[model samples]
Target: MVVKSHKIHDVEMVEALKEARQKIFTEIRKVIIGQDQVIEELLISLLARGHCLLIGVPGLAKTLLISTLAKVLRLKFNRIQFTPDLMPSDITGTEIIEDDHSTGKKVFKFVKGPVFANIVLADEINRTPPKTQAALLQAMQEHEVTAAGTTYKLKEPFFVLATQNPIEQEGTYPLPEAQLDRFMFNLWVDYPSEQEEIQIVQYTTSAYSGQPQVVLDAEDITAFQDLVRRVPVATNVVDFAVKLVRMTRPNFDQSPKFVKDWIAWGAGPRASQYLILGAKTRCILDGRPTPEIEDIRAVAKPVLRHRLVTNFNAEAEGVDTIEIIERLLEKV
Candidate 1:
């Protein structure tokens, strides 16, 4: 009964957010030319309090989109450029000795790093070594950073929006599967259309500037995130999510043949959890009270893409991750 009351209250918030979504899109359009899908997924991930990973090449405005989002949402933003030589301390701050003027003695001080922000853009995350990448694991999962035996809570509404260059692998270290599973969405930022490209060139060649209005603040975002959790979902919708995740595993008894042939390792329980959360957020953004199977379908690709690891058979048959996921979706 208490859950029913929370859902009723959240419905009002969801209704109001319907307009905010349009306002946010309008504000973002000032600077961005296209990639509406990417923006929407990013918002879903942020509002659900989940981390996101974007796979794109250089010059795709991945950085601009995130920075513009931070501006529109009025959140603190930071960017860390990952490189081969980057160290863990660089991403998570290290302890330093300081002279205490009050006591005339030496003291240890922990200067926060770029990770101590509301929105963190981890640029070229794959370029760094595993050790450096591991620094983000705790922060992404726990929303807190532990250094020198002390754990510091990160700011509210915190999320790590990481980007990768898919075209480059010469010096890049692929993210460990453990780290990959931490992200709720693995979005692809494709090349812009011809018309969009022309518009992008036109905008950049001139003094045209786009300043998106501040849509929501930290408090509103935190409340909405709580509301997303409060939204109700049907039992069948939950079952579909769980079943979709299970079918990805090659060893499951009722798994699809293509999955057994192509997939090396399937997604775990986390995938199911994200599917529901993402679906809930999607319906709310569209002003719906509860999610349906179709809502789960819409979020399946991004949620499952990075989770499924293809095997040799998949490679020989020329079946990619997206194709495997699509075929599985067809069966359901």
Candidate 2:
């Protein structure tokens, strides 16, 4: 791990956050039985000022995870249960006519939707149509909402943690790749282990008095995000991340044989950006001052998985993005 040797800014803040990580986990564990990796990735995206898309089947506690995390961070939380009838205005909000107190005249006022909060959980996001789904695109990318030709800035440390059901498709409108690209990390929430499931059942069936305490606020999160951006990475590590992202594109001459054979499309520059951001945050969360090439590789899968489009050969051969990414890691 080659890290540029230098004095990191806000050393005290980084050290405080590093120590607070265990406390945050302890609070989250009160409600969440397991899924440590999922929690870590969510925090990485949060601290990096990026959004995430969680793909998992129902009953995996996806909703609970984000909500619990919001509690742990002490951030304002909102949840929207996306459905077929959900409209774009239901997300970005709508303007209403109201009487003006000063002028005694009817005036239009914009009402903030669930998107105005610090952490918004787009539950069952794919259940909504593309038109409704695209409502979040701007807010996720620009941290602002437009209503009736007026733009309103979202609160600081804003994040949209969206969840999608991978098993159900009958009535679900799949999210387009363009919208998917807005997410920094496409995290997979897997099922709990047997023992963990047993613990979950017992815990839920019993008193279930678990409660998570707050660890940080909006301002604190914003400061840490700034700190993560300031973390130094060796130039070679950055080149490695760029090379890994470039290798995903099958048409590029530099891509490997397997990538060309199986992948029809590749990740764009945003993937590279997220790779570095996520890596830096992960490094800092572990009490390190700098990120390395291995940090880039560690964040590679979540950063690239949703951005990839496999060809027919891949589907026929049953090669998913996970396998493709694993091979890409080895190739890189």
Candidate 3:
């Protein structure tokens, strides 16, 4: 196959970006034994400048994967353990009155919280109340925070990798569809294989210790993100993505019969945009100059999982949103 070359400003820069991405992936694998697909999708989300929601049972190493990726990329990392009683001010900093000794006057200062980091691990996000969860809306959408009538921009290359427990719902507040729409991908982390499980047990039982190496600096990561945006997509591939998203809406005339009955809402335009950007990132990681249709298909589940909303009937029937997505893909 004759792959078309990327229209990067400097051709050599692409080579450097490829090397940096590979090195970071290598370092991440040192600590994370399995779930290579999850890691790759997470990387695609990062490069596409979108947030991710990781859903799985506990002890799947979701936190370890995000933290290790932060370490390998040499980015500031912070973890926020969400709880039902958590308040908005807890995640986004609060204003406190302080007495200035030098000026002899009182002033309100905003103390930064974990949300200001380059990489944030929102552990058990569903445990937090909706009020507290709203604190991340501005940061994820605008890359800025508004507190006490002041807007503070977050650091560049900011990425939120939030994890939620799928099995527990006792004290968990289900994420509102509006908030869930903010995420680019809803990655499902599953248990390891027999061989991988054996390796995990052995590695944990042993006393082996190794620190994560810094494979790429912040500048390089930002550059690669920009490159992902610039990657070219053919008209046909773009149309394919658009059609896939449109078919998810139950109200749409062209939607599949199952989707029309089961889905309450379909994915919006952002889904198509993220789908293209994610495919571009996936292609780059796979050493391809341009994205292919298979790349879009590979990422469809993660990209649309959270975006599509199912009706109560679908839920009562124990049908998943992914099944509706698959039906749409087949029709499209």
Best by TM-score: 1
Assess candidate 3 and give its TM-score to the true structure. 0.93
Model 3 lDDT tens row, 115-161: 99999888998888777888876688889899988999899899998
Off by over 4 Å in 3: 1-10
TM-score ranking from best candidate downward: 1, 2, 3
- Candidate 1's TM-score reads 0.97
Task: Work out how many backbone clashes candidate 2 has.
Answer: 0
- Tens-digit lDDT track of model 2 for 1-332: 11222444467666877887888899999999999999999999999999999999889888888889988888889999999999999998888999999999999988888899999999999889888888887789888888877789998989999998888889998888888899999999998999999999999899878878888777678778878888888898889999999999988999999899999999999999999999999988998888888899889989999999999999999999999999989988
- Candidate with more favorable, higher lDDT: 1 or 2: 1
Q: Against the hidden true structure, what lDDT does model 3 obtain?
A: 0.85
Q: What is the C-alpha lDDT of each candidate?
A: 0.91, 0.88, 0.85
Tell me how far candidate 2 lies from the true structure as C-alpha RMSD in angstroms.
3.6
Ranking by lDDT: 1, 2, 3
Number of the candidate with higher lDDT, 2 or 3: 2
